[model samples]
Target: MFNFGIFLLLLGAVLVYATVPIIKIFNITTTKGILVVKLSGLALAVIGAIIMFFAQFPQRLEFLRLI
Candidate 1:
């Protein structure tokens, strides 16, 4: 479950990480389009963070314990 949560967070980050350049790629002519893209990315990140925070990743990663 923890790993799944982390994966989701990373997935969200990837979505957020892609939003700007991808929007720019399509040559959106309006400010509204840009705003919408940014907002969607923000929503994805928030959802990811919610999952990550509730995941308790620290309790599951043995490798982290070694470090």
Candidate 2:
């Protein structure tokens, strides 16, 4: 669980970092694509943070261990 959480966080960070360069390279000044990318990145980061946070809790850790 902890490992998964860390993986998710890293993946999210990578996605955000990667997408930024592409957007910049293409000169994506339009609101649509930029908004979509931003929203997706935000969602991914939030999900990753939530997973990491729950993984740190003792009860959640125990529950995860059971799985």
The most accurate candidate by TM-score is: 1
Q: Candidate 2 — which pairs collide?
A: none
TM-score of each: 0.59, 0.56
- Residue by residue across 35-59, what tens digits does model 2's lDDT show? 7776777777778788877675565
Candidate 1: 10-residue stretch with minimal lDDT: 58-67
lDDT tens readout by residue for model 1, 1-67: 5666667667667656786677768987688887776677677667777776665666446556432
Q: Assess the local accuracy of residue 1 in candidate 2 as a C-alpha lDDT between 0 and 100.
A: 59
Instruction: Tell me the spans in candidate 1 whose CA falls farther than 4 Å from its real position.
Output: 1-20, 56-67
lDDT of each: 0.68, 0.73
* Candidate 2 worst ten-residue window by lDDT: 58-67
lDDT of predicted model 1: 0.68
Error of 2 at 59 (Å): 15
